[model samples]
Target: MSRPEPLQPVYQFSSAQEPVSLRQGTVEVDFNNDRFCGMADLVLRFLPGPRLVFHAIVRSTSEPELPFFLNVPDNLSVSFNGQKMEGFRGRWKANGNTLEFDWIPRSQPVVLSDMQPKNSVAAIFHLFNFPEFRGGNYQEVAPLGCALLVLESEDWKISLQELPEDATREAWDQIKNEGGCFLTHMVKMERKDGEQFSGEDAQEQCFLLDNFLSFINGGRCWPVCGVGLDASGETTWETFASPRPVRPPYSWFNPYKASQAELLFPLFAKRWQQSAEWRDCLHSAIYWYVQANTSGGSPSIDAAIILAQAALERLAHHYLVVDQKVVSGKGRASDRLRMLFSACGIPNEIMDATPDIRRANGTFKKDTRWMDAPHAITDIRNSLVHPVSKKKLHDCHVDAWKLSLWYLELSVLALCGYDGTYVSRLTAKYVTDSANVPWGKKA
Candidate 1:
């Protein structure tokens, strides 16, 4: 028929003539040309997410650069780690030996799976070649050569292929040196292609990175209380032994073990309680709060506030127990309460009043004031507990909560007859030094 259509030009090639190799972590892949006969340029890409997916594109070398297509034969097979992958359509034709497919070994969270083989790099390889021309018919061409492709997880990519093991360890050490608190954020890799990924600048993401590194570095456990250094390089915890007599070991005695007052007094007298001063207190408070609320869970604003309040309460109790006047109840309850108010330096007249303390104006009767600060604190607590509000939360809420807790602790200490200086010191350590607070080593 028309001289057999002059035998459409059919060219055959084999991957056996050319070869390519690629490696990532412990996974390795090799490609050879003899398998498919064709000239082609191969491209590979790696993506990060629930599962690792590798994509490949192959273009055949032709006068105008033709697309590679394949009508895959029944004998052809695709596999990962020696295991044949199922569900391939197997309907591609040889346009130029170009093929595309995902190479996810299994359907699972990539972080939790062991996709990379030990001592072998994970990669996707492509083989290309052209088929030889026959008398008057065309025959399917086998694969010629293959090119390897690699894709890495986001963190792996940012770390430049380095595993997270070391960075985590370093972060842990930093957390241990500071208080028990460890915060970090996620960091996205800078793509060579100049594209930005999601959450690249989120502050929480940065915190996540820090915390992850801390956990991996064995810095999870740290002392929460006791004497420690503050931002100013001065000891924040006031010891009874210090020149300040208001420090600790007050007259208040534990009713159950009055005899042990001597033992407990010395502990209190040794130092002014500081949430920031003692690494142990900070550590313990954070640890206890986290254990009580957030262990093995995601972080939330309410959880953070609850943890902070718990820590503050512990510090307040230690200060209160050490004050002499509070233990003996020598002054009027109202007066004692007033002294507590003065200690924190809050001029709220209601602070010194008893539950029945009436207002001089007499317009509002009954202990409404008692419900005020404590109620305000409770409102803050509620906000912390239930953070799901349509309104955006600002950092000021945390600052207010911290200030309130400090005031509460100072008042408790004042009721025990401790001077107010400790409150000032604590404020300086936490509020004024907020910007200068030492972050753990770079994760």
Candidate 2:
């Protein structure tokens, strides 16, 4: 008998590599720099704030201690534990491509010192700690990685209850303006003889780091995040980062996937970049999707429907009014829908889920056909925004809301240029997932 094919998923979550021990915490970083023929053993540790500790174990037959000169940006000052060192010094050779220096202390073989960022600089490393780091030190590991946190002197830790809005803005702006965010780096030491191999594994880890840190640097970090969960319902101050993969592991269950959004968003953004009538209206609509997904109540439901109506109007306006270069003479929701569907119809595969487009075209226009659902939809939208107690909506339900949103999704998909399995997948999940429905499995 032939084996049945596995089900396809819409999108899979990203998975990351297992963390290697870095002192007490686990880090995900790449540290195999321009490898120049030799075993350069290295152990890196992050000690809160701006302190970075590197333990390089290289085979002997040279000077007792060599100064490591790194061509770091001007604002940073390196130190041996507490005492500071000049960036350009004789003992530490800063000439040529190499930045040679001894991280080891005077009378101690165990070099436990720090490389600190200067006054105007703040640094962070990629130290991911999930289940505590155990079973041998990072000395035995092949991959090298570390931590990277936000800049500014604990500006990420201010009491929102006390700080004024202007002060908060000032602090945030100053961190960026003074060029304080550049203070971050990683030092790689690969043993030249210990099995020379291409550093393939660390490639993904490096990519993941850059991908996430870019978002955070662009002001995406949620201040006061829930770091841990105690059964007693308490919290901790540590901004503890845990293991996170860039993308989920590939499996046969997920056949193939790509974003349909890639094709069309550029068109909308480019065309509407300068027009406030189009721009702000589009934002309001998208934000309503967030509210609809997150908030629910009688009044909130009304607000969501109204905002969703607003968003849908803006998106429809993208192709209809904007593309046609016309005005909303009648300014009716049905008029907009007629123009929108005419301009950008639903994706063919999922067209069965949305029949309202028929009403836009068919002569039985305002009758109770699925095509006529727009009139009812607009009526409900008007009642929600400008309420009337007597007007009942037979179309108002969970699936109806899904249909409206899915219609918006389809319209967006149409604008974005998508007609693929993703459209069918969305149909299956959103439209047909409900039991006993016309498009669902039961039907």
The alpha-carbon lDDT assigned to residue 316 of candidate 2 equals 69
Best-performing candidate as measured by TM-score? 2
Model 2 poorest 10 in a row by lDDT: 153-162
Candidate 2, residue 380: the lDDT equals 63
- lDDT per residue, candidate 2, 295-323, as tens digits? 24433555556655666777767656665
TM-scores for all candidates: the values are 0.23, 0.35
**Model 2 backbone overlap count:** 33
lDDT of 1 by residue, 1-443 (tens): 12111111011111111211221221112223323222221111111111123232333233323332323334333333333433223223333445443343232111212322222111111111101111111111111111111112232222101112233234334434532222111112233333332221222222222222221111222111112122343332210000000111111112122122222222222222332344344335434333333322344445555654565455444434343324442432233333444445554432322222223223333543234444334445545667663323343354334444444434333332332122132234331121111111222
Runs with alpha carbons beyond 4 Å of true place in candidate 2:
1-256, 259-282, 294-302, 347-371, 389-391, 419-426, 430-443
lDDT of candidates 1 onward, in order: 0.28, 0.32
lDDT score, candidate 1: 0.28
**In model 1, which regions exceed 4 Å deviation?**
1-298, 322-341, 344-374, 382-443
RMSD to native for every prediction? 26.9, 21.1
The lDDT leader among the candidates is 2
